[model samples]
Target: MPVSKKLPQLFYGGDYNPEQWPEDVWLEDMRLMKQAGVNIVSVGIFSWAILQPNAENYDFGWLDRLMNLLADNGIMADLATATASPPAWLAQLHPESLPVDENGVRFSHGSRQHYCPNSKAFRHYGQGLVRRLAHRYKDHPALAMWHVNNEYGCHVSRCYCAECTVRFREWLQQRYGTVQELNARWGTNFWSQKYYAWDEIALPAKTPTFANPGQQLDYMRFMSDSLLDAYLGEYRILKQITPDVPVMTNFMGAFKPLDEFEWAKHMDVVTWDSYPEPTAGIPVAAAMQHDLMRSLRGGQPFILMEQVTSQVNWRQRNPLKRPGVMRLWSYQAIARGSDGVMFFQWRQSRAGAEKFHGAMVTHTGDENGRVYREVAQLGNELKRLQALVDTRIEAKVAILFDWHNWWALELDSKPSRDVLFLEQIGHYYKALFDAGIAVDFVQPHADLNKYRLVIAPALYLIGPGVSDNLEAYVQQGGTLLTTFFSGIVDENDRIHLGGYPAPLRKLLGLCVEEFDPMLPDQTNGLRVRGQGDLDGDYKCTLWADIIRLEGAEALASFTADFFAGSPAVTAHTFGQGKAYYVGTHAEDAFVAGMLRRILSDLGVQPPVMTPLGVEVSERRAEGRSYIFLLNHLDQPAEVQLPAAGFTDLISGRKLQGSVRLSANEVLILHKDTEHAV
Candidate 1:
């Protein structure tokens, strides 16, 4: 089977913390769960304290009873390995499990993610506990998937411990092969900071700070890799006991702590916790995360591991998801190729830090609440149409999101503060979205031939073979877009000098002479070089790279500055394809307007071109394509879809090409079965 019932269609439920509440509550919780239509529960996430209360003693009585109850209740348990936050006893006994911050101070373990990733004691015990747990319930009828860890890198930027320092040296050796090469790449000779031996190096301290961004960036990579190793350690044990089961770790959305691309290599299926802010452009932000998760598996459907049933407790303000927001977001995930939709919690906790966090059954323990009603309705709808839940969405555009580049660029204090990486990438993504284009957010090393247009915004760190892969894409006539502050650094956060935009200068057809960072109010105008529909003056700022155009033509020029009339945007026609470089940040209009022309020049068209605040996506499987039309507006509006003959999957009504939708309404049209995957 291409899919598994272990992760059933439209996964209907979320986290269950039997460890927090008493055993008497389990039956009632299960009763409330069935009433609220929760079919799956993620158990054992934070049960380390209960499962193994002491070093010598292991208690499985509570968890075993909980799993048995779930089996009897017809509920599937998304069994977590119970290794996110180590028990207090272990941390107290083995002090090495506690993480040390960048300031070289040991942190107290009150919250989760405080364990040292490189600690041998933590790995041995953590994996041992998981092995025992998996073996105990490996063949349980209710066990679905093995969830490895909970939110792998919630505190992404920590860890300056002795173990990390030692491991960092080894990671450097493997990456650069020798100390001399490492020293040269890091420019250690500049400050007379060259290391004669590997053991001499220390973790970069933050308080009495040193301006060594390259070292800091490399250390971040080392830390993320270390955590990945920790996850794999437990994962290996689980697979050893139960080889047929799929394993996963929940990722934070667009989280920069660890390279998710690298982490995805070891996962059986990619899963994530999705909680976009209410103020955020819902579809755009959620789409980016969903595409990111999907891209990890190269367009394979991923699991929506955790979303809040009502609201979250962590943010400054926990607001209830508006009436249709939940359903719309759920379908949006499906529309973006998600095979499962689960929440952070099943039942509300009466006590704990997460008590206030929204749950299906509130503190009242009644199903009369508004949140419960919404959950029930959504669950019923999903149950009615389970066949559509495992569908897929494929696209013609791919944007490369490299955590390596993201870490290196942010740590490099040299770049302008205005060059915020995710924000810049969001600009291009928003442009493509506004133009109604379907995009696959991908890793740096994804198959280039799958996408007609591949955008790599601020690819600061040039990883192994990425340049060659990109060059091959351009050679094969695919449109490539890269920006300034890109191609300047290597994988180790070391500068690639000789010329600016190092490895990709030839491919981009522009040699960047110098770049000047600007403030928020700073302005640079772009004058039209050659006349087209976009011949008017446009605004650009934040940073301007004076371009030495080799084979590329200046499409737009800065109207004012020392380098006035210099190229702000350039395009190189290489072989049968082209590469465009945006030298500085431009307005959204400029980006959208420019990209439309470029995508048009390449014959790429949006499935259904519509106005802003509306999202159109198509999910296809089993010889049927379901076009999801969402109107994120207060007022009703009409959209002219591509086809006249189709039935709305939501309303079960036939629709013409010109169709109408109400405010916050979703119209899923079963259109063009021939093109379905």
Candidate 2:
């Protein structure tokens, strides 16, 4: 389900904790919310303690009044299950609910997410509360969407307690079936750690030197699944009681612990929280995260569930968002593929852990504040652009972002500790972003037919059928780009044996004899062979695969070190498609130049040409497209419009030639005459 049927426009507003203040303050909140054009408020997210003050007693009196007040004010409620953090009493009554760290020390109460996901007692009380809340609020007119536990596995992703140990073994048994297969997969024979029985297998905790790599990978999977089970426990109950409400949980963007792709399968709609540091200044990392969340459901529009209006409180030194940064970032979210834009709070707290966190209504209790004004302006813009709701972003290029590969590649025993997964992905993503090209993030197992070009950056782990899928895709005339250290290991973190990049060696027509892992300060030069923009030498760093071309032609060669004049990059024509492999991590300029050449050959072009610091994105709906132009700089920038005259949705002005946008400005252009405008 999408957001509730009643919210036809963009769902706005955010976390509102009325129980944190006096009763009279709620009326003022409603008044200010309407002034700020707030249409929805996520309430009761952290209200478990107040809602059920004791084990046997429950209170719906205040919630009933709050719901009625919200409906009367024409605001919808993204009603939360309030199961994120259990009550202090529950932890006191059942200490087993607490999570124990890898060091085997149990965490105490006071902080949030202290409960162990696999604890039976915790699940019982948590699901019980969810059932009560669901039944009580099922028919409430203000209920819009069901916000499941807030940011699952945020603080405590794993527990080394005995309960988790038992659950982990059961999970392993279910996956591998027998102790013999477990030993084979985990490679237990290496350190004489072979287990004769299922009970002998231990959780991959702090070992003498290092835990088995395969065991560590499996434990990550188990922890993700265990937390997912906890979310599903409440989800099943909520669906059983209020089947109409759409259930969702906020994901921390680019979070590594949980496999969000698997979790997205169970979510009614995808949503995530974004909190980028201001110093980064609109980095490509944040854009990649937005596209990643959009790709979770195959290009479906997701929600901007939680963003700070200004600065975050958790960072060591929280800096305020410069004048228009909040609005710029909010539009960036929508431009990528967000249907709704919401913040982490409606009002700033007077006292709490998040007292300093930015909010729509600050502690000064004035609607005339700069943050409030910017919030109201964006709200009004969203109200005007209601036709853009439910639209989707289309991309001809996709980058594979796999969580399994991320975990395996980051393990302790990798060739180069400097080889970071997301950094590698960011390199490719930034190339495309700077070129004004639209791109989608995809899973390695997702269908490759939709994209003309697929780039897999350091795809270190190739799971079952991925090699075959890529082979088929390449043989059927698709272009693929992958970097060094890819296809080196299987899903079990076991080497593919014959050579590096084992499975893809045949497709790429190359064999890597060995890897040359470079230190941080080391560097090499890559001399381009053919013409075009990549005809010069470029600096290569981090890693270099000693490659020997089989059926592929060398496009570049190492110009330094003992492997000088060796193949550093190669391209092969397989059937009707082409595959290119970069055996070394080259500089950004080389990657961009090579990508531009490849994209040109594949007939892929950006929607519009733009100057640096200006971002362009498009969303399509009802046969019409809306082109978003945003300036991320402190100075004015100009963008040439398409030959066809278009109307600016924000300014309601028709433009034909080049238009200049002021610093931190945004424009939504509708191509020619459009529908539902």
lDDT top scorer: 2
Highest-TM-score candidate: 2
For candidate 1, lDDT tens digit of each residue in 102-202?
66779887888778888898888888899898889999988888998789878734687888888888998898888888787778887678988888878
Count clashing residue pairs per candidate.
0, 0
Error of 2 at 231 (Å): 0.4
**Which portions of model 2 miss their true places by more than 4 Å?**
none
Model 2: lowest-lDDT 10 consecutive positions = 1-10
C-alpha TM-scores of all predictions: 0.95, 0.99
